[model samples]
Target: MDDPDSNAAQLASPSYRLPALDQDFLLGDSMRGVRFQLEFAKAEEVLRAWGIRTTLVVFGSARVREDGPGRHADWYAEARRFGKLASLRGGAMRDVGQVRDNVIATGGGPGIMEAANRGAADVGAPSIGFNITLPHEQEPNGWSTPGLTFRFHYFAMRKMHLAMRANGLVVFPGGFGTFDELFELLTLRQTDKAPPIPVVLVDETYWRTVIDFDAMVSHGLVSPSDLSLFRFADTAESAWQSLIDCCLKPHPPSDYVPVP
Candidate 1:
């Protein structure tokens, strides 16, 4: 026979807690796989609900600022302009469709990321910010749609989400972090691990100075054909055109016309 006090104690014990409610157990080392799945599923479910079918990912330096020194302002402005242009023409403005293509996606932090997100906000289009947990604690830019902003602890998981839905890639001048992401996608493209997608490097002069593709070819570090994987553009208009030339499909204007 169970005494009332003993029954109460048993019910309150940690061991008796439901698995889902046991934070200690759920966060333990053994549950890492479960945590990974949870991370993936949480974002996937929300994206599906929001009908984000394809994304135009923008990668750039977080150090750039609108009013900062030198070409930083130019880079920021172009990124913002590209974001708005892409949203306006890339089917992201369609209210009647169940799918949104070419929606602007960013790192969800400041600098170029904030500029792109702000561009989407300019025309009242929803954007995505895939933020990562960093030691310095990067915050999501205010321009990304509140419901679509997400933070992940694992860089691998964050990158997977970024790459999995990308329809095109627009890269701006950046340093180590940006190079990491740029090369990863380039490698995937070279190996055919990812489907062919348009890749545009904004500011041909900046990119040419930063990466010596010709030198790579001369050194046999990369094949001549590998250089064809991406193109260079000097402005937002040219960047969009480069994507179009490389077969980044945009929905017909009629499909995005608002229903009265």
Candidate 2:
């Protein structure tokens, strides 16, 4: 019902958009490669701006609660304590100008992830939560620092962010997702794609019952040296200490900077 000239004018207006405003175009397969770069850069830019030089990834079952269940209760407590200890000792609680190292990072959901991020919060330090969309609905734990929390649609991109700045990886009792991350690091270490950072599994009892790394070695399926790729810790203190022993030197001077 409009004149041809007015119709043409409306079409040329700013309100008339291109494919840039089309969600279908952006989410389509043809734009996947662009999405990948955006995913990588988005997290990287924020992390860099925040001065996150190193990261310590904490992985575990989302089902574990702070108290309700038995072993779950114990693990939740231990993970929380470990988060505090790691943040205190690893430099997350240092003054703004001080060197920041091993900033606590987690899957950014409840369970052990919340415990770890909560520990860092206890010390009034910033922590990171790398969460992914899931069928069952996983949300970022509230304990993680506000600006540092991130959500990703792609699992590969999510894992990339986890490992990229990782200085240590600590795994607690968990199932498939935990195992996926745990073994991915192991494989990267095994294949020499990753540097030998400390990889500690919480609770010797749980880990031993779950998998037989020794059996794998005995069967010649894996070399005996492969077993050294990870070790076990029964408490938070021991776990954080092992990371210091395995990869980090004693807390450096506040002003210390590595000479390149």
Alpha carbon lDDT at 243, candidate 1: 94
Query: Which numbered prediction scores highest in lDDT against the true structure?
Result: 1
lDDT of 1 at 3: 75
- Provide the RMSD of all predictions against the true structure, rounded to 1 decimal: 3.1, 4.3
Candidate 2 segments exceeding 4 Å error:
8-19, 97-99, 250-260
**TM-score of model 1 (CA atoms):** 0.94
lDDT per residue for candidate 2 within 68-184, as digits (tens), equals 577999999999988877776776765665556789999999999999999889877789999998998988999999999999989999998999888999999999999999999
- Give lDDT tens digits, candidate 1, residues 1-260: 77766678778899999999999999999999999999999999998888899999999999999998999999999999988888988978767446889999999999999999999898888999999999998999899999999999999999999999999999999999999999999999999999999899999999999789999999999999999999999888899999999999986346454221
Residues forming the 10-long window of minimal summed lDDT in candidate 2? 251-260
Give the lDDT of residue 108 in candidate 2.
97
